[model samples]
Target: MTIPTARTTAPFDAVLCDLDDVIRLFDATEVTRLERAAGLPVGSTAASAFGPGRGGPLVLGQLSKDAWAESTARGLADRVPAARARELAAAFARAPFRTDPEVVELLRAARARCPVWIVTNGTPWLDEDLATLDLDGLADGIVNSARLGVAKPDPGILLHAAGRAGAAPERCLFVDDRAANVEAAAALGMATVHFRTAADLRPALAPLLARPVPHPRR
Candidate 1:
């Protein structure tokens, strides 16, 4: 679908966007199935994997995705047998993900006027995941925390992203599904969109798609 245009000048110089939940969504069916087969609760595996002490290293570039999966299996050892726990962890790690087309389109529209950068707290394999969803082309630049050894809410990464987009913090519009991330961007002088749905993106990006009319010659 074609994005609508406006005459007023865009407010921001660049767009800083998140990946998970903002544009990419995961299907946890495999994780659920594995949990059920192991006689564990549906959220049990997720709790073990994402709970404190587990996901941090993986997202911070300290651990590989395989190592994280193994760590998740270890986290489940007390509740299930070793082999079953490994299976469950593998399922959760490989959960299928898809992009939000509406959000993608909005970002695409915004990109026409200014750079759109993906600034996400993600694992090292994030590029592969983006390629799988065919979303690698959408962003002009990507700031993956794992690659940079930093994550959201850290002033360094956000500043780094704004710099990558060639925009100052105050002239950037940062969008993320997490409130803490949005709050961090705001603290850094960026305009933020606490993204919950595609609807949240449209209005926040509207000003960035607007073009100011040229002044008549004096």
Candidate 2:
């Protein structure tokens, strides 16, 4: 990766943001329907799908999405039939997600001042999802744990993200919905936004958003 030279003026030279629950939100309707049809509880699919034993390998790039789905199915084998469990797992795994427009706009505004990188613990299809959201190029770069064989709360991934953003950890603003991820970034000397609503980002990014983008000298 070609890391850019950090610009000195902005409060944050880079914005390292999370993807799931922060930018992309999943629709649980299909998963709910599948679980209900299989006589399972609403959160059962999610519980199995996201559990470390089943989902960890997928995020760490050790397992393919299909393999993860199969693992999740096996996790629910005692509760449902093999075929039904597989159906539920597949539906949950492939659940649709949408971008938070308000957050996207704010990030775009911040990008006018400095690079914005999506740093996330995500599956290999992460880029394809970004493309579906029309956000492929919204961020200057992306640091996907599935691609890197590491996940958040791990200092190495955060450091890799900061490097990709071309900023020292202290000069980057890390925004994530998870407190653990935020704390990890803070410990690395990066400013953090433990995001909840789009409003949570306004103040943290206000300094950069308020400034006008400078035109290149001809």
Candidate that would win on lDDT: 2
Measured against the true structure, the TM-scores of the candidates, in listed sequence, are 0.88, 0.90
**What C-alpha lDDT values do all the predictions have?**
0.87, 0.88
Per-residue alpha-carbon lDDT of candidate 2 for residues 55-134, written as tens digits (9 for 90 to 100): 67878878777888998998899999999999998888789889899998899877777889999998887777777787
Pairs in clash, predicted candidate 2? none
| TM-score for candidate 1 | 0.88
Superposed Cα deviation of residue 87, candidate 1 (Å): 1.1
- For every candidate, C-alpha RMSD to the true structure in Å: 6.9, 4.7
Which runs in model 2 stand beyond 4 Å of their true positions?
A: 1-9, 216-218
lDDT of 2: 0.88
lDDT of 1 by residue, 1-218 (tens): 99889643568888999989889999998889888888998899989887778777778988788988999999999999999999999998998889889998888777767788999889988877777777645889789999999998898999999999988999999999999989989998999999999999899887766654333312
Error of 1 at 91 (Å): 0.2
Q: Considering every candidate listed, which one attains the maximal TM-score?
A: 2
